[model samples]
Target: MQRNTYGQSPPLHHPVPQHVSTVPQLRSPPPPPGSAQSQQQGYAPTGQQGNPYQQQGGTSGNVFGAYGQFMNDPTAQVAAQFGQTAFKQGQEYVEQNIGRYVNVAALKHYFNVSNSYVINKLFLVLFPWRHKGWSRKQAVGANGQEGWYLSPRDDINSPDMYIPVMGLVTYVLLSTLIAGLKGAFNPELLGVTATTGLSVVIVEIIALKLGCYLLSISSQSQLFDLIAYSGYKFVGIIVTITVAEILNGGKGTGGWIGWAVFAYTFSANALFLLRSLKYVLLPETNGQPSGPMQTDSRAKRNQRTQFLFFYSYIVQLFFMWVLTRA
Candidate 1:
């Protein structure tokens, strides 16, 4: 059997035995006995010519009807809404009631005054060449999704890679757009916080589909697909900061920065959730979802996602230590 780019076995291959066969005849299964019809009708014993549904007693038509029924059910809607839904709603409810009392304008003023300090510190994390003199692109070889070796080359739109890219990019863009709109207009509105967070979750999931544009362009591994798109988000933060500085007369307004970061953090969670979902998503049978809703990976992904949510409010820590201190 041909090995995949990864050292591990590919998902597509049948499991092969460890030892090579020394005696082929001993391993072969005895042929099925001839049916009486073969003798009565003067038929030859060709195995391939038997009924198509020999062991499985049905046709493809039966499966199609079962799927049709699933689509028409209402309970599936409730299940779809409830994924990590409890915690997300609870957090939003708290943020809306809590954040309203704080003087948002004063907070914005503080952030504006602190912008230069923040910007100088943030330069290292944002601008690699200026700060660290180093750069990293998407992994070039077997570190990719196939579990192969350092396989050569990179393609952003590879079949395995495109879905994650779409899921990530759509997530970030939608969240940013929503937060920017909210901050630009109603920074302290309760609805903005709740709507934006829920939007992040919904878009994160909705983005998983294999779509028309991707069908035309995707040709990379799943890992590279995800990483490349995330690179663009890094670029986006740079752009947002540059614009923020210009609009706020050097130190950007706190309102805009807070909401933008809020969007960014939730989007990060979306990325983790989408990637973990990819891991366990076996091919659907009869149009059903592949695995249990609460797999181990699903739980891990949710933990990281939840961490991003709470951590977003204190993003100074992330930028200061992780990004600025580099």
Candidate 2:
């Protein structure tokens, strides 16, 4: 049974398609240039589109270029030159002015000794009788000074402070050792002994100077010369003590045997000084004088000889005894 109306048929229905098209769709066009939408879409502004790594490298290159320019600047070069000039001037000033306080040349000359010189000097101090030459060797300086004493290495008779200073230290150490063996050692005992020894030397020098002044003995020797001669007694003192200690079975106190040894040493040291110091106290003369002035010079020379004998015998004996007690 079909019932069809004149104006209306049954409404026809169509199902929607379930499958999508396989063809690629076109994307929306990029937003207009210079618009906020372009920026929001991660597009760089005009004239700024480049690699990020290239921009970073350019920044580093600019920094290095600036540093190079600064280093090559005229002001930096001037500063470097100024620093060098100041250092050079300071060194020159020190060299020029330092001589006022210290005689650097003389110090160097005094210390310019060799191993052979030291060994020979020690042997000479211990056994001075064998050496015949007592006068220091002389040299002619560049300035035509004829009496310049040779260095210790060249002249065995040349005086030096090195041996004296070393002997002083050894004396102090030996005194300490002796004190320890006697069970009387203290830390302060070393200082006391050193002070005593130095005091004795100073007193002896003062006495000798006074004697020279009173006797009108005009010697060309420097103060260090006298000190060097005076310090030689330490060698004899050290030998005497060592022998005494050995004979007495390590005892510091000496007996009759020690006295005998000391006497021999004392006589030997006196003779050594008598021979060595004659050149200093009495200068050699080529001709003898004949007048009142000659007589006066002769008298003064005799007085100086007596003073030397007194110093060599009496002064040395007293000081040597004092050191042995220390």
Candidate 3:
């Protein structure tokens, strides 16, 4: 009321003290070396901070780094794709054609052939003359067994691939052993021998297929049967070579005994193939020739059969000769 002239007596003149708030200062201890917080702050590990020569812990990092460049490389991708494609194609081909060529179940059945049957067949294969009641054309026995048959019995549907495969492997192994005994073993030569023998078999298969084609015979299964039949020559080959090797008696080559055994086996193999393959080479007709036309056709078929039968003999002889050299 004394200074009313200043404005309304200074509005009661209540001097309120100003309040000032202060926060306590904090200094967190510097993060310990190699701690999570320090690492999070982009600090290097304790020993590596100033040492450029510090070696890494594991070498796998370097390995991964080297190969990783190719992981995305276009050329590597192309090569990988190509290899996969080729492998798939080859697998498909084998899956489709292997059974058509080599039937393992049939092979196993034929491989179960008895020793007596083999011996009898061997004799019949060699001589082929009618001996007692056993002839090449005698039907399979009542016991469902092929008895004294040269080739595979017509009724018995087993075309064995096992015997021939075993025979080939045994022949190669024996030949290698013989070469080793003579101090002339060469692994290279062993490979050559295998290739030679395999080529001969392949050629025989091809030739038989060609013959069937030329004859206008549409029997792929029969052609494969013929191949299996032809492979039996390996059995004769093994026998002939073994006999020759034994009779040679360190002579380094066969003598008269070897040649004689070879001759017998060769003839046997030819005869076996002749009787075995006749049905395939010349399928018999149920009807007899009733006219000149029929006779002429029959005669032509007979001539072809004879020619093919002789061809089989010649091929057997050549292959046997090659095998004997081992």
- List model 3 lDDT by residue over 1-326, tens digit each: 46666556565667776985887999776478768876554445566556332224423334556677787789999999999999999987886687686674444445565555555554554566443332234336698654432334332324545556766787788788888888989988778778877888888888777876666544434755676777777777777777777777866337888788888777877766776665566655423121112223766686768667666778778877877775
- Cα RMSD (Å) per model? 31.6, 17.7, 17.5
The pairs that clash in candidate 2 are none
What lDDT tens digits, residue by residue, belong to model 1 across residues 1-326? 67877777766868899998797566554344476644343334566535433324323334556667776677766766785698799987876777687544323322232334334423332332333211112333464432321211222111132222343444445434544655653445345434543444334323422331222212223323333233223333434444555565645424566446535543543343233223223212221222223323555555544443433323322332221111
lDDT of 2 at 183: 89
Ranking by lDDT: 2, 3, 1
Q: What's the TM-score of each model vs. the native?
A: 0.21, 0.64, 0.54
**What is the C-alpha lDDT profile of model 2 across 1-326, one tens digit per residue?**
34477755666688877996788889998677778877555555557755453345334434556768888999988998999999999987887799787666766676778899989888887778999988677787688655567888898888777887788888899889877888888999889988987888788778877875676454444455777788888888887888888897876648887888888888888888888877656554522111112214767888878888999999899999988877
What TM-score, to 2 decimals, does candidate 2 have?
Answer: 0.64
Model 1 spans > 4 angstroms off: 1-222, 252-326
How do the candidates rank by TM-score, highest first? 2, 3, 1
**lDDT for every model?**
0.38, 0.76, 0.64
